[model samples]
Target: MTGRRRWSTDEILDTAAELLRTSDAESFSVRKLAAALGTDSSSLYRHFRNKTELLRAVADRILLAAMDGYRPQGDWKQRIAALALRLREAFGEQIELAVVWGRYGSGGTGSRLVMEELLQALRASGLPDDEVPVRYHRIVILLASLITSEAGINTVAPKEYEQGMEQFRVAVLGADPERFPALAHFARDIRPLGADRPAAFEDILAAHLAQIEAQLP
Candidate 1:
Protein backbone atom coordinates (compact mmCIF):
# COMPACT_ATOMS: atom_id res chain seq x y z
CA MET A 1 0.00 0.00 0.00
CA THR A 2 1.36 3.42 -0.96
CA GLY A 3 0.22 5.91 1.67
CA ARG A 4 -1.91 4.56 4.50
CA ARG A 5 -4.68 6.97 5.34
CA ARG A 6 -4.65 8.38 8.89
CA TRP A 7 -7.86 6.95 10.22
CA SER A 8 -9.94 8.95 12.71
CA THR A 9 -11.54 7.29 15.73
CA ASP A 10 -14.91 7.28 14.00
CA GLU A 11 -13.31 5.78 10.92
CA ILE A 12 -11.70 3.06 13.02
CA LEU A 13 -14.99 2.20 14.70
CA ASP A 14 -16.83 2.14 11.37
CA THR A 15 -14.17 -0.09 9.81
CA ALA A 16 -14.12 -2.31 12.85
CA ALA A 17 -17.90 -2.78 12.63
CA GLU A 18 -17.57 -3.70 8.97
CA LEU A 19 -14.90 -6.24 9.83
CA LEU A 20 -17.02 -7.69 12.62
CA ARG A 21 -20.02 -8.04 10.35
CA THR A 22 -17.99 -9.95 7.79
CA SER A 23 -16.20 -12.29 10.21
CA ASP A 24 -17.08 -14.42 13.21
CA ALA A 25 -16.11 -13.29 16.73
CA GLU A 26 -13.59 -16.13 17.16
CA SER A 27 -11.54 -15.02 14.15
CA PHE A 28 -11.95 -11.27 14.75
CA SER A 29 -8.80 -9.57 16.03
CA VAL A 30 -7.00 -6.25 16.04
CA ARG A 31 -4.52 -7.41 13.43
CA LYS A 32 -7.30 -8.45 11.07
CA LEU A 33 -9.04 -5.11 11.47
CA ALA A 34 -5.78 -3.18 11.02
CA ALA A 35 -5.04 -5.13 7.87
CA ALA A 36 -8.50 -4.36 6.60
CA LEU A 37 -7.79 -0.66 7.20
CA GLY A 38 -4.34 -0.85 5.63
CA THR A 39 -2.64 0.06 8.89
CA ASP A 40 -0.78 -1.62 11.74
CA SER A 41 -2.69 -2.98 14.73
CA SER A 42 -0.85 -0.47 16.94
CA SER A 43 -2.72 2.34 15.22
CA LEU A 44 -6.00 1.09 16.63
CA TYR A 45 -4.66 1.07 20.19
CA ARG A 46 -4.39 4.87 20.03
CA HIS A 47 -8.19 5.02 19.65
CA PHE A 48 -9.04 1.95 21.73
CA ARG A 49 -7.10 0.85 24.80
CA ASN A 50 -7.73 -2.84 24.06
CA LYS A 51 -9.83 -5.30 22.09
CA THR A 52 -12.66 -5.10 24.62
CA GLU A 53 -12.80 -1.34 24.29
CA LEU A 54 -12.69 -1.61 20.53
CA LEU A 55 -15.52 -4.14 20.48
CA ARG A 56 -17.65 -1.98 22.72
CA ALA A 57 -16.99 1.04 20.57
CA VAL A 58 -17.96 -0.86 17.45
CA ALA A 59 -21.10 -2.20 19.07
CA ASP A 60 -22.12 1.27 20.19
CA ARG A 61 -21.53 2.62 16.74
CA ILE A 62 -23.76 -0.07 15.28
CA LEU A 63 -26.47 0.72 17.81
CA LEU A 64 -26.32 4.41 17.09
CA ALA A 65 -26.51 3.75 13.40
CA ALA A 66 -29.55 1.56 13.96
CA MET A 67 -31.36 4.19 16.00
CA ASP A 68 -30.33 7.13 13.84
CA GLY A 69 -33.82 7.96 12.66
CA TYR A 70 -35.78 6.44 15.51
CA ARG A 71 -38.09 8.74 17.42
CA PRO A 72 -40.18 7.69 20.40
CA GLN A 73 -43.73 8.77 19.71
CA GLY A 74 -47.23 7.72 20.80
CA ASP A 75 -48.05 6.14 24.19
CA TRP A 76 -45.64 4.29 26.41
CA LYS A 77 -46.26 0.84 25.02
CA GLN A 78 -46.17 2.11 21.45
CA ARG A 79 -42.95 3.97 22.08
CA ILE A 80 -41.39 0.93 23.67
CA ALA A 81 -42.57 -1.22 20.80
CA ALA A 82 -41.14 1.18 18.25
CA LEU A 83 -37.81 1.30 20.01
CA ALA A 84 -37.74 -2.49 20.32
CA LEU A 85 -38.59 -2.92 16.65
CA ARG A 86 -35.80 -0.56 15.68
CA LEU A 87 -33.33 -2.47 17.80
CA ARG A 88 -34.52 -5.80 16.41
CA GLU A 89 -34.15 -4.52 12.86
CA ALA A 90 -30.65 -3.32 13.56
CA PHE A 91 -29.53 -6.50 15.31
CA GLY A 92 -31.25 -8.60 12.68
CA GLU A 93 -28.79 -7.23 10.11
CA GLN A 94 -25.71 -8.51 11.99
CA ILE A 95 -27.10 -10.64 14.76
CA GLU A 96 -23.60 -11.70 15.76
CA LEU A 97 -22.86 -8.15 16.89
CA ALA A 98 -25.52 -8.36 19.59
CA VAL A 99 -23.28 -10.73 21.55
CA VAL A 100 -20.53 -8.12 21.59
CA TRP A 101 -22.96 -5.45 22.77
CA GLY A 102 -24.19 -7.78 25.49
CA ARG A 103 -20.68 -8.82 26.61
CA TYR A 104 -19.39 -5.38 27.52
CA GLY A 105 -22.66 -3.49 27.54
CA SER A 106 -23.44 -0.58 25.24
CA GLY A 107 -21.15 1.83 27.09
CA GLY A 108 -21.38 4.71 24.72
CA THR A 109 -23.34 7.93 24.23
CA GLY A 110 -25.84 6.17 22.02
CA SER A 111 -26.51 3.58 24.69
CA ARG A 112 -26.90 6.22 27.34
CA LEU A 113 -29.41 8.05 25.24
CA VAL A 114 -31.26 4.79 24.60
CA MET A 115 -31.31 3.98 28.31
CA GLU A 116 -32.67 7.36 29.22
CA GLU A 117 -35.26 7.15 26.51
CA LEU A 118 -36.32 3.69 27.59
CA LEU A 119 -36.64 4.79 31.18
CA GLN A 120 -38.78 7.68 30.13
CA ALA A 121 -40.96 5.41 28.07
CA LEU A 122 -41.28 2.88 30.85
CA ARG A 123 -42.13 5.61 33.34
CA ALA A 124 -44.91 6.69 31.05
CA SER A 125 -46.42 3.24 31.49
CA GLY A 126 -47.66 4.32 34.93
CA LEU A 127 -45.51 1.83 36.88
CA PRO A 128 -44.66 2.89 40.42
CA ASP A 129 -41.15 4.28 40.89
CA ASP A 130 -40.07 1.23 42.84
CA GLU A 131 -41.04 -1.12 40.05
CA VAL A 132 -39.38 0.82 37.23
CA PRO A 133 -35.89 -0.53 37.71
CA VAL A 134 -36.99 -4.15 37.80
CA ARG A 135 -39.20 -3.74 34.76
CA TYR A 136 -36.43 -1.94 32.90
CA HIS A 137 -33.95 -4.71 33.56
CA ARG A 138 -36.47 -7.32 32.49
CA ILE A 139 -37.11 -5.61 29.15
CA VAL A 140 -33.40 -5.17 28.47
CA ILE A 141 -32.69 -8.80 29.33
CA LEU A 142 -35.51 -9.97 27.11
CA LEU A 143 -34.14 -7.92 24.21
CA ALA A 144 -30.61 -9.26 24.58
CA SER A 145 -31.68 -12.88 25.03
CA LEU A 146 -33.98 -12.80 22.03
CA ILE A 147 -31.39 -11.08 19.87
CA THR A 148 -28.65 -13.54 20.82
CA SER A 149 -30.87 -16.55 20.29
CA GLU A 150 -31.94 -15.33 16.86
CA ALA A 151 -28.34 -14.60 15.91
CA GLY A 152 -27.19 -18.07 16.96
CA ILE A 153 -29.92 -19.71 14.93
CA ASN A 154 -29.06 -17.59 11.91
CA THR A 155 -25.49 -18.97 12.06
CA VAL A 156 -26.56 -22.63 11.92
CA ALA A 157 -24.57 -24.80 9.52
CA PRO A 158 -25.56 -25.28 5.90
CA LYS A 159 -29.32 -25.64 5.29
CA GLU A 160 -29.74 -29.22 6.38
CA TYR A 161 -30.68 -28.31 9.94
CA GLU A 162 -33.79 -26.58 8.72
CA GLN A 163 -34.63 -29.49 6.43
CA GLY A 164 -34.15 -31.93 9.28
CA MET A 165 -36.51 -29.93 11.48
CA GLU A 166 -39.14 -30.02 8.76
CA GLN A 167 -38.68 -33.77 8.41
CA PHE A 168 -39.14 -34.21 12.14
CA ARG A 169 -42.31 -32.19 12.04
CA VAL A 170 -43.63 -34.38 9.25
CA ALA A 171 -42.79 -37.49 11.20
CA VAL A 172 -44.60 -36.18 14.24
CA LEU A 173 -47.62 -35.41 12.09
CA GLY A 174 -47.62 -38.99 10.86
CA ALA A 175 -47.74 -40.34 14.42
CA ASP A 176 -50.95 -41.98 15.66
CA PRO A 177 -53.53 -39.37 16.62
CA GLU A 178 -54.70 -41.41 19.64
CA ARG A 179 -51.29 -41.55 21.25
CA PHE A 180 -49.99 -38.10 20.24
CA PRO A 181 -53.09 -36.17 19.49
CA ALA A 182 -51.72 -32.81 20.64
CA LEU A 183 -48.52 -33.12 18.63
CA ALA A 184 -50.43 -34.34 15.58
CA HIS A 185 -52.91 -31.51 15.86
CA PHE A 186 -50.23 -28.82 16.10
CA ALA A 187 -47.93 -30.39 13.53
CA ARG A 188 -49.07 -28.09 10.78
CA ASP A 189 -48.27 -25.05 12.93
CA ILE A 190 -44.95 -26.42 14.15
CA ARG A 191 -42.14 -24.25 12.85
CA PRO A 192 -38.41 -24.71 12.90
CA LEU A 193 -36.61 -23.12 15.82
CA GLY A 194 -36.17 -19.39 15.29
CA ALA A 195 -38.52 -19.52 12.31
CA ASP A 196 -41.01 -17.25 14.05
CA ARG A 197 -38.43 -15.05 15.69
CA PRO A 198 -40.19 -11.79 14.85
CA ALA A 199 -43.49 -12.98 16.26
CA ALA A 200 -41.82 -14.48 19.29
CA PHE A 201 -40.01 -11.24 19.97
CA GLU A 202 -43.25 -9.29 19.71
CA ASP A 203 -44.99 -11.76 22.00
CA ILE A 204 -42.29 -11.37 24.60
CA LEU A 205 -42.50 -7.60 24.43
CA ALA A 206 -46.26 -7.74 24.70
CA ALA A 207 -46.01 -9.96 27.74
CA HIS A 208 -43.67 -7.51 29.41
CA LEU A 209 -46.04 -4.65 28.68
CA ALA A 210 -48.99 -6.63 29.99
CA GLN A 211 -47.14 -7.42 33.19
CA ILE A 212 -46.27 -3.78 33.69
CA GLU A 213 -49.85 -2.78 33.03
CA ALA A 214 -51.17 -5.35 35.47
CA GLN A 215 -48.81 -4.21 38.20
CA LEU A 216 -49.44 -0.51 37.75
CA PRO A 217 -50.73 1.12 40.95
Candidate 2:
Protein backbone atom coordinates (compact mmCIF):
# COMPACT_ATOMS: atom_id res chain seq x y z
CA MET A 1 0.00 0.00 0.00
CA THR A 2 3.05 2.27 0.06
CA GLY A 3 2.34 3.73 -3.36
CA ARG A 4 -1.41 3.21 -3.36
CA ARG A 5 -3.64 6.05 -4.52
CA ARG A 6 -6.30 5.40 -1.94
CA TRP A 7 -7.33 8.68 -0.36
CA SER A 8 -7.50 8.98 3.38
CA THR A 9 -9.81 11.27 5.35
CA ASP A 10 -7.06 13.85 5.72
CA GLU A 11 -6.34 13.95 2.02
CA ILE A 12 -10.02 14.28 1.20
CA LEU A 13 -10.46 17.11 3.70
CA ASP A 14 -7.46 18.99 2.38
CA THR A 15 -8.64 18.60 -1.19
CA ALA A 16 -12.10 19.75 -0.20
CA ALA A 17 -10.66 22.81 1.52
CA GLU A 18 -8.62 23.71 -1.54
CA LEU A 19 -11.79 23.36 -3.53
CA LEU A 20 -13.66 25.57 -1.05
CA ARG A 21 -11.02 28.28 -1.22
CA THR A 22 -10.77 28.17 -5.00
CA SER A 23 -14.54 28.45 -5.16
CA ASP A 24 -16.99 28.92 -2.31
CA ALA A 25 -17.71 26.11 0.11
CA GLU A 26 -21.46 26.21 -0.58
CA SER A 27 -20.85 25.87 -4.31
CA PHE A 28 -18.37 22.97 -4.07
CA SER A 29 -20.02 19.71 -4.99
CA VAL A 30 -19.03 16.15 -4.13
CA ARG A 31 -19.65 15.12 -7.74
CA LYS A 32 -17.27 17.78 -8.95
CA LEU A 33 -14.69 16.73 -6.41
CA ALA A 34 -15.11 13.13 -7.45
CA ALA A 35 -14.60 14.13 -11.06
CA ALA A 36 -11.50 16.13 -10.22
CA LEU A 37 -10.02 13.27 -8.20
CA GLY A 38 -10.89 10.73 -10.90
CA THR A 39 -13.13 8.70 -8.65
CA ASP A 40 -16.82 8.00 -8.52
CA SER A 41 -18.88 10.29 -6.31
CA SER A 42 -19.93 7.21 -4.39
CA SER A 43 -16.37 6.89 -3.09
CA LEU A 44 -16.83 10.18 -1.22
CA TYR A 45 -20.10 8.96 0.26
CA ARG A 46 -18.22 6.17 2.02
CA HIS A 47 -16.27 8.73 4.07
CA PHE A 48 -18.93 11.42 4.38
CA ARG A 49 -22.57 10.51 4.48
CA ASN A 50 -23.58 13.91 3.20
CA LYS A 51 -22.41 17.43 2.45
CA THR A 52 -22.89 18.42 6.09
CA GLU A 53 -20.50 15.68 7.18
CA LEU A 54 -17.97 16.77 4.62
CA LEU A 55 -18.27 20.36 5.80
CA ARG A 56 -17.60 19.24 9.34
CA ALA A 57 -14.53 17.35 8.16
CA VAL A 58 -13.35 20.44 6.40
CA ALA A 59 -13.94 22.43 9.62
CA ASP A 60 -11.97 19.97 11.69
CA ARG A 61 -9.09 20.21 9.28
CA ILE A 62 -9.03 23.99 9.58
CA LEU A 63 -9.49 23.96 13.35
CA LEU A 64 -6.69 21.46 13.80
CA ALA A 65 -4.44 23.80 11.87
CA ALA A 66 -5.77 26.76 13.85
CA MET A 67 -4.97 25.04 17.13
CA ASP A 68 -1.62 23.57 16.03
CA GLY A 69 1.49 24.45 18.04
CA TYR A 70 -0.59 26.49 20.50
CA ARG A 71 0.83 26.38 24.04
CA PRO A 72 0.28 28.56 27.06
CA GLN A 73 3.23 30.69 28.11
CA GLY A 74 3.85 33.72 30.34
CA ASP A 75 0.97 35.14 32.43
CA TRP A 76 -2.62 34.06 31.86
CA LYS A 77 -3.39 37.21 29.88
CA GLN A 78 -0.33 36.75 27.74
CA ARG A 79 -1.27 33.17 27.07
CA ILE A 80 -4.78 34.13 26.07
CA ALA A 81 -3.38 36.77 23.73
CA ALA A 82 -1.17 34.14 22.12
CA LEU A 83 -4.16 31.92 21.52
CA ALA A 84 -6.11 34.84 20.14
CA LEU A 85 -3.32 35.73 17.76
CA ARG A 86 -3.02 32.17 16.53
CA LEU A 87 -6.76 32.03 15.88
CA ARG A 88 -6.66 35.35 14.05
CA GLU A 89 -3.76 34.36 11.85
CA ALA A 90 -5.43 31.09 10.96
CA PHE A 91 -8.76 32.72 10.11
CA GLY A 92 -7.22 35.67 8.28
CA GLU A 93 -5.42 33.31 5.95
CA GLN A 94 -8.72 32.03 4.56
CA ILE A 95 -11.68 34.39 4.52
CA GLU A 96 -14.24 31.72 3.71
CA LEU A 97 -12.85 29.43 6.38
CA ALA A 98 -13.06 32.30 8.83
CA VAL A 99 -16.72 32.82 8.02
CA VAL A 100 -17.47 29.16 8.51
CA TRP A 101 -15.44 29.07 11.73
CA GLY A 102 -17.24 32.07 13.16
CA ARG A 103 -20.60 30.48 12.34
CA TYR A 104 -20.08 27.43 14.55
CA GLY A 105 -21.31 27.50 18.12
CA SER A 106 -18.48 27.56 20.66
CA GLY A 107 -18.98 23.86 21.44
CA GLY A 108 -16.86 21.93 18.96
CA THR A 109 -14.04 19.82 20.40
CA GLY A 110 -11.33 22.11 19.16
CA SER A 111 -12.95 25.25 20.54
CA ARG A 112 -14.03 23.53 23.75
CA LEU A 113 -10.62 22.07 24.45
CA VAL A 114 -8.97 25.41 23.89
CA MET A 115 -11.59 27.11 26.08
CA GLU A 116 -11.15 24.54 28.85
CA GLU A 117 -7.39 24.97 28.84
CA LEU A 118 -7.71 28.75 28.93
CA LEU A 119 -10.25 28.63 31.76
CA GLN A 120 -7.98 26.36 33.78
CA ALA A 121 -5.11 28.74 33.28
CA LEU A 122 -7.26 31.71 34.23
CA ARG A 123 -8.65 29.96 37.30
CA ALA A 124 -5.13 29.14 38.42
CA SER A 125 -4.36 32.83 38.07
CA GLY A 126 -7.06 33.60 40.70
CA LEU A 127 -9.83 34.56 38.25
CA PRO A 128 -13.30 33.35 39.17
CA ASP A 129 -15.02 30.79 36.95
CA ASP A 130 -17.83 33.21 36.10
CA GLU A 131 -15.30 35.85 35.14
CA VAL A 132 -13.45 33.35 32.98
CA PRO A 133 -16.50 32.95 30.74
CA VAL A 134 -16.87 36.67 30.22
CA ARG A 135 -13.17 37.22 29.67
CA TYR A 136 -12.92 34.42 27.13
CA HIS A 137 -16.00 35.70 25.31
CA ARG A 138 -14.51 39.18 25.07
CA ILE A 139 -11.19 37.86 23.83
CA VAL A 140 -12.85 35.71 21.17
CA ILE A 141 -15.12 38.54 20.02
CA LEU A 142 -12.24 40.98 19.81
CA LEU A 143 -10.12 38.53 17.85
CA ALA A 144 -12.96 37.55 15.51
CA SER A 145 -13.85 41.16 14.86
CA LEU A 146 -10.26 42.11 14.25
CA ILE A 147 -9.60 39.20 11.96
CA THR A 148 -12.74 39.79 9.89
CA SER A 149 -12.53 43.53 9.70
CA GLU A 150 -12.34 44.98 6.18
CA ALA A 151 -10.33 47.89 7.55
CA GLY A 152 -7.64 45.65 9.02
CA ILE A 153 -7.05 43.66 5.83
CA ASN A 154 -7.43 46.72 3.66
CA THR A 155 -4.50 48.08 5.61
CA VAL A 156 -2.46 45.25 4.11
CA ALA A 157 -1.05 47.14 1.12
CA PRO A 158 0.49 50.06 3.00
CA LYS A 159 1.15 52.41 0.11
CA GLU A 160 -2.34 51.94 -1.20
CA TYR A 161 -4.60 51.87 1.89
CA GLU A 162 -2.32 54.14 3.87
CA GLN A 163 -2.72 56.95 1.36
CA GLY A 164 -6.46 56.35 1.28
CA MET A 165 -6.61 56.36 5.07
CA GLU A 166 -4.57 59.54 5.16
CA GLN A 167 -6.87 61.38 2.83
CA PHE A 168 -9.91 60.17 4.74
CA ARG A 169 -8.32 60.93 8.09
CA VAL A 170 -7.51 64.46 7.03
CA ALA A 171 -11.04 65.11 5.80
CA VAL A 172 -12.72 63.57 8.84
CA LEU A 173 -10.37 64.92 11.53
CA GLY A 174 -10.19 68.27 9.82
CA ALA A 175 -6.41 68.39 9.92
CA ASP A 176 -5.93 71.68 11.70
CA PRO A 177 -2.26 72.30 12.40
CA GLU A 178 -3.18 73.99 15.66
CA ARG A 179 -6.48 72.36 16.66
CA PHE A 180 -5.69 68.69 15.96
CA PRO A 181 -2.13 68.77 17.20
CA ALA A 182 -1.97 65.09 18.17
CA LEU A 183 -3.48 63.94 14.87
CA ALA A 184 -1.06 66.18 12.97
CA HIS A 185 1.86 64.94 15.07
CA PHE A 186 1.15 61.23 14.68
CA ALA A 187 0.06 61.32 11.06
CA ARG A 188 2.80 59.02 9.92
CA ASP A 189 2.08 56.61 12.75
CA ILE A 190 -1.55 56.37 11.63
CA ARG A 191 -0.42 55.69 8.10
CA PRO A 192 0.11 51.97 7.57
CA LEU A 193 3.53 50.53 6.86
CA GLY A 194 3.74 47.35 4.82
CA ALA A 195 5.87 45.83 7.54
CA ASP A 196 3.72 47.03 10.44
CA ARG A 197 0.92 44.52 10.04
CA PRO A 198 0.55 40.92 11.38
CA ALA A 199 2.92 41.75 14.24
CA ALA A 200 1.05 44.98 14.84
CA PHE A 201 -2.12 42.99 15.49
CA GLU A 202 -0.28 41.01 18.18
CA ASP A 203 0.74 44.22 19.90
CA ILE A 204 -2.82 45.47 19.75
CA LEU A 205 -4.12 42.21 21.20
CA ALA A 206 -1.48 42.38 23.93
CA ALA A 207 -2.73 45.80 24.93
CA HIS A 208 -6.34 44.57 24.92
CA LEU A 209 -5.34 41.60 27.12
CA ALA A 210 -3.80 43.97 29.60
CA GLN A 211 -6.99 45.98 29.71
CA ILE A 212 -9.02 42.80 30.25
CA GLU A 213 -6.75 41.63 33.05
CA ALA A 214 -7.11 44.99 34.73
CA GLN A 215 -10.88 44.49 34.76
CA LEU A 216 -10.62 41.04 36.38
CA PRO A 217 -10.11 40.41 40.10
Tens digits of per-residue lDDT for model 1, 1-217: 6776889998887777787777776688999889888899887888888888888887887678777988788999898888888877887787668878766777898788778878999898888888888888988888888877787877766687768776777687687889989988887887667577889989989987988888778
- What's the distance in Å from true for residue 45, model 2? 3.8
What does candidate 2's lDDT look like per residue over 127-211, in tens digits? 7777878877776676666665633454245587677767676654567768888877776566533345677777878887677
- What are the lDDT scores of the predictions, listed in order? 0.82, 0.68
TM match of model 1 to true structure: 0.86
Best by lDDT: 1
Candidate 2 has an lDDT of: 0.68
Which 10-residue span in candidate 1 carries the lowest summed lDDT? 153-162
- Tell me the lDDT of model 2 at 6: 69
Estimate the TM-score of every prediction.
0.86, 0.66
The window of 10 residues in a row where model 2 has the poorest summed lDDT is 148-157
Which pairs clash inside model 1? none
Instruction: Please list the residue runs of candidate 2 whose C-alpha ends up more than 4 Å from where it truly belongs after superposition.
Output: 1-6, 40-42, 49-52, 105-109, 150-200
